[model samples]
Target: MTLGFGEGRAFGYAGCNRYFSGYTLRGNRLDLGTPGSTKRYCEGEGGEVERAFLPLLAHPFILQREGEHMRLIASDGTRLEFEAAAMESRYP
Candidate 1:
């Protein structure tokens, strides 16, 4: 997945769909506003990951970065890990 955050906006491709949301961050805590995304169901794991990912974005999560990796830690300790991807590489 690819994530971009700036100017109170968060947008990215969540495995299958592209999503945009409002966000606010203070220190280590981050709150995500309701996200809207394109409605395109992907086959197999892509669709399933999208379904699980959307709701996770609706709540508060912690952002941690280590080297080239980023982790989004949910309130319940569920962690979503991401790595920086080149813009030239397309998502499946």
Candidate 2:
């Protein structure tokens, strides 16, 4: 999955679908609005991952950054890890 955040908005590939939402960051706490996604249905694991990932955005998160790597930690402590995509392949 690839995510991009800028100007208080978030957009990313959620395994099967592309998702977009508004987000706010205040220190370590971050809040994301309900994500909107394309209506494509994916089968098997892709579908499962999309289902699971979208809801995680409903809760508050803690952002952890280390060099080019980042992790979004849910309130209950679930960690979603990501790395900066290469410049030539930034959008996915």
Candidate 3:
């Protein structure tokens, strides 16, 4: 999974589909609006992943960063971690 933030928006490839939402950050708390995604039906593991992952975005989460790693901790104590990816230029 990949997530990117820019211009008060959050967007990413959410396992089976691309998703986008408006976001607000206050200190370490991050809140995201309802996400919009392409209507694509995925099967098997992808489908299971999508179902489990998308709902996590609905609730606000605490953001933590350490070096190249970032973690999002939900109110229920569920944590999701991500590492920074190599930057790729959009124009080449």
Candidate with best lDDT: 2
Model 1 C-alpha RMSD to native = 3.3
Candidate 3 lDDT, tens digit per residue, 1-92? 76778766787777888888889989999998878887799998887888888888999999999998989999999998889986322211
Best by TM-score: 3
Off by over 4 Å in 1: 88-92
lDDT of 1 by residue, 13-48 (tens): 888988888898899888889888888869889888
| Model 2: colliding residue pairs | none
Model 2 spans > 4 angstroms off:
86-92
The lDDT per prediction is 0.81, 0.84, 0.82
What TM-score, over all chains together, does every model reach? 0.83, 0.88, 0.89
Better of 1 and 3 by lDDT: 3
Give the per-residue Cα lDDT of candidate 3 at 90. 23
Model 2, C-alpha of 37: deviation from truth (Å): 0.4
lDDT of 2 by residue, 30-82 (tens): 89898998889799998999999999988889999999999999978899999
CA displacement after TM-score superposition, residue 39 of candidate 2 (Å): 0.5
Output the TM-score of candidate 1. 0.83
